[model samples]
Target chain A: MIENELRPKVNEFEIQGTNFSDYQSPLFIAWQLNSICNLECLHCCEEAGEIMPNELNREEVMDFCQQIVDLNIPYVAISGGEPMMHPDFFKICEFFRSNGISLKVETNGLFINKEVAARFGKLGFRSVQISVDGASQDTFEKMRIKGNFKKVIEACKFLVEAGVNTEIVFVPTKFNIHETGKLIDMSYDMGIYGFYTGKIMQIGRAGQNWDILCPSAQEYEEFFKVLTEKEKQYAGKMKVYYYPYDVIEELKYRLEKPSASLLVIPNGKTKLIGPLPFVCGDLRKSKLSEIWNDYQKAWKKDEVISFTKQVIENPELLKEANKWREL
Target chain B: MEFQKHVKVRQEKFGAVVFETLREKIFVTNESGAQILSLLQAGKEPEAVTNELSSMYDGDPAVIKKDVDEVISTLQESGIIKN
Candidate 1:
């Protein structure tokens, strides 16, 4: 499950508390291991390339993971250029699982072979979201610039068959919005727990080709219309969920309180969700607990809050709100 | 009233976060609500709970009676309290 989705709407939400020990304990954290992904998606958010440097070495990452587990963080979503590319992927998974922290790995699905799937099943991950990108192999290949499309499909199937709670993530870009139904049907046929779809947030390569990559508001609405019908059709058989690009308006409500989750980049920078380039602190510079304690305060920082207010005012900012893009 | 099966409850200092896992619904309530929930979970009768809370908080009989009745009604409405 997306930690962002569990953020309470307002004070009225069922998730509330008082007399907290340490607000430093985040409900969840999404950490990017490194940005050296093999497949370069057209709308790559991290602008991930083949070359990755300045990443936390395995020892540093292990130390940080230990700190996170000690802080009693409930969930962690390990993503990357492709998290599976991390040299210590299995070690990291084992460490987190042993610490009683539920893990959810998000990857391009290229790395999950039968062996990887068996290890994941052994460790008992809460879930794993392997990006499908498109409904058909041709369309998937088109969006995901390089990769043997069959391998990714094989990887997903292997994970599911191995008893891993595998989730397929389909990113709806302009090129494949029409094939969303196929994507849902594909999930229904496979019969895993569910699948996730979300609108492409224009950034990096996506921002450069926003006109071609990003779907228009009308197009997304039409897509969701089809999705809603599909959801009804597969209500009992399969669960299909999508994050609409338009729902960032809810961020305004979210800003009233501390965020339920936080993101950590490969370089250990505490990052904001979506395309925003706001970094609160480098985890290497301070403890994860310290950074989390300051997370609510981080949102109040001038430029970030201004950008957020601007987002509240102009919701379209969400579609393409990268700091580098503005420059 | 007994809580439905899978109505998982966790008590906190201030109150509790009750999760009805089957429905995937969570309810956040204050300390008083937590007391009522604990009492209910222990299989206390409504009248007995009312008497206990009324004595504990030094509340008026009629006011406590009405208040307890309303709280039970609300919990019942939300399917938190089961027959």
Candidate 2:
């Protein structure tokens, strides 16, 4: 028998004079391999293209992957500016696969071709998330800005056909909120394993264009209700995971409690929360444990619970809750 | 957050080096550049530093002024330099 293949390493380190723990059990690591992307999406959080030649090089990424393997992290998501745009992307995947790490990749779906999808399937990646903001070419192209919507759909088809555990990530916006249900149906028709929705955060390009980017809380909740009903109708075939705000009380039973997750930027700077301001520390200089502990302290349980409750009860509070990272 | 236009030292695996944060981009510099940055941090204007740098390094004042101006513009764009 494979003796409990997943085991987390418990190590401590310090960051900016604060102590923390690293890679606690049940936690996931999000490694941002590069801040360079093939297509510059309209609402990119990283403002990716601005920073070229990100600090963490190929060797550094391999070493970091090895450390996660040593720690036996249950899962790790390779994200980007556009992870596929990384010169050593395949090598990184091969390293993770050899280490028995459950891997997930978040991509724009523009760069992924049939050959790449097949390779990912061969590597046994647990999941691949492709973002499709709109249902039709006109809507999708407007937001995605570069690639054709048909190309993205083609990529999705490739992943689904390749027997990959595929997810369609739809970002609800004023432009695409109305098409949420259609997008889900499209995802289902394409043989997608699941669909997940993300609420746009007001940061980076989105922040700059808040007038057009930020959707009202009511609009989001309405869309959520529609999607939830659709999910019920198509229950056995495909799974749908809503964003934090859209999740209802009844769905909470199915919702997994938020676990500790770490996001390391391309420069090796690590942050406990999702993309936002302030990094805990640079992983190369500080031990992972130290950064984790300091992050835990920052993430006050009482505060998070209270804020979460408020958001569920009053959708208007979603904006405030999304900024949990900054707090 | 707001950052001031100045040279900050970042220690990398290679060695301790200075980078001028112009907006968010980190631009590395040599000893002479560092000295000029220090002078700027000390509230010296480009014009004021021209004579001093010319006497110290035996370089042309016009060249020094041109270089300082270019760096300052980049720093301003990067949010490292404020009026």
Candidate 3:
């Protein structure tokens, strides 16, 4: 029998609308819990290691979570420099879980012990995605500077043993590209439920290391060929999801359709995703629903469209606009 | 006899989408299966579901009963229904 905890939250929204695409509410929130990270990885997108001064307080974070509950958002994906490092991480997770909001977490996995993994299982989180950048300890330590490869491996085991649905998130860099197949094998061996990997985005600390870390076009092609074969091999056994980065296609997609998910930073501000740096509204200053609607509408603005066009035509414009600038 | 608390059926034009919320599983049923599921969700007994389906469709009563029983058994196996 499928356990009660295995059921997904029935989205009334899916039934009410004739077409799923026509429905406008943000399907989920990518809430960055804190800026504090325990690792200083070579490709750290947020360069996250220390907490920002303006990080949201527990009360504010709880209020924002309550707002999400009120808005009836069924799912949330929490991440951070490392989300588990958040002072009120469990409290925030409990709020969402108790409200019947399904959750997925993106973490560095250094903090997950047996007790923590069991708690995650008991809370019934949808899945926990732990970053595992390399297949071997040497490459892992090289990419995830200051990260303990053995500790993370142990964490994955603990999560799996605790009955928590654990997954791996890999950012294919020069150091880890060759190990993609090996890592997937390792993840499957660990009893991971899914494997999510993608081309390392050239932003933040990664942008600084792009020349050295970014995989060559030929290397990416070779890696993807291996990935396709692995997908078939793991078809029924484990789920494999990857995002092959294409700058032009991604920019055009963003121009035509905004993300169906809101990106809430550690400071409670709803920022647009990378490339078109726009802050729609602050959750602390406005209702989440209002901010979400405004964000959707912001996609069609003349300035936003024009900026996106210029960037699409001349990708270098992205470098200047990538910072969190008010639109 | 009825859907478990976690099972939710959302009617679609073609049929219905049954969400087993706990395990996050989804079952897409055809029109007849949707009717059977809805009847079962409305607290109908297996025999009553067969009768209701028989009245609505042109299938033979005996075949309808067998189909209903099959659907019920499948739902039970999937943990969507409880006795």
Candidate 4:
């Protein structure tokens, strides 16, 4: 809605209504496969590099797949330092698909070659979003060290041709801000379905470099303005989402009730929100119904509300929010 | 004693819609199937369900019991229900 707040005269093109509806039993899930990442990007949040010692083993993950199905979370977003980096990535995908959950995988596109791209299309995944920090190799390499921009673009093309619904995530950082327009253009030209752009948060490795990488006030304002104009121009041809996402605002009273969205960390802990460290209950220790009650209760805590408020007000707080101490 | 993890039920105007949860690619049934599931979900035991259905429909006890037995066993085999 913040995107609509800019110009007062409701343009006919003014995107009206909302995609969110009443939350059902089990709606969405943010399921982390592992923190292990193949790339060490400068902006790596979660600072995920190598697999952690207590990371869930294969058997544990397989065991929990049934639990996740038991939870009935219909929409799952499989994420990680790099989710494709998980050895059992496809196995996990197969489990969720067999049980009835549609998945959206967030990956760095490094692992998706042409053959893999074709197989990925057949997996029943709803979408596969690859993070494209910059339009060109130089800017992309500097922001996400060791990235192959050409390879990612080629992967996207292959995936699109293979019938996999591909999308691009453009995180606006100092290095990539200038090229986002071209990136959007490329996504539209390439027939990519959606283009999502959001401000960088102060979390993970990005938190360490926030002072230098985070856009200045003028730069931030200018970026969204550019996005707004492009969104208007690309209106129907390519879907665009500019963030400072008021996604949850429309569900005000609903947030107070219970979140149908479940977050399961690699350690099998049920995290309240993406940032909130409050552990509801370990999924391994309790039934989802019992832990789910804890999830509902966690939402009412003062810390949770205040955290939500801060990020809603200053989306930049996202970078440091998960740190909790800063909150 | 519980519905399988993938088992899910959706209520409609006529009756309920039941299906295997993920991908919903497995079992899906309506009417009497949905009614039996709703009863089980509400914590009714197998024998109790047969008795209840017999009383509600005024069907022969032996006939209803036989049908319920077949349905319950099929549910068990499909892993949609457990003891």
Largest TM-score belongs to which candidate? Answer: 3
- Score each candidate by Cα lDDT: 0.71, 0.64, 0.77, 0.70
lDDT of 1 by residue, A212-320 (tens): 8878889888989998898899887777777654435446655555455678878777776655656676777889877776666666677777877887777557555
User: DockQ (C-alpha) of model 3?
Assistant: 0.12
Per-chain TM-score of chain A in candidate 2 equals 0.79
lDDT digits (tens) for residues A242-327 of candidate 2: 75642344223212233355778888877544422435567677666666665566445555445545545664443332132433
Candidate 4 pairs with clashing backbones: A99-B22, A100-B22, A100-B23, A201-A319, A202-A319, A202-A320, A203-A319, B1-B82, B6-B21
Clashing residue pairs, backbone N/CA/C < 3 A, model 1: none
What's model 3's lDDT at A279? 83
The superposed Cα distance between candidate 1 and the true structure at residue A239, in angstroms, equals: 1.4
User: Whole-model lDDT for model 4 versus the true structure?
Assistant: 0.70
Q: For each candidate, what's the DockQ? A: 0.11, 0.01, 0.12, 0.03
User: For model 4, what is the error of residue B67's alpha carbon versus the real structure, in angstroms, after optimal superposition?
Assistant: 35
Best by DockQ: 3
**Location of the lowest summed lDDT over 10 successive residues in candidate 1 chain B:** B17-26
| Count of backbone clashes, every candidate in sequence | 0, 11, 11, 9
How do the candidates rank by TM-score, highest first?
A: 3, 1, 4, 2
* TM-score per candidate, chains pooled: 0.76, 0.65, 0.79, 0.70
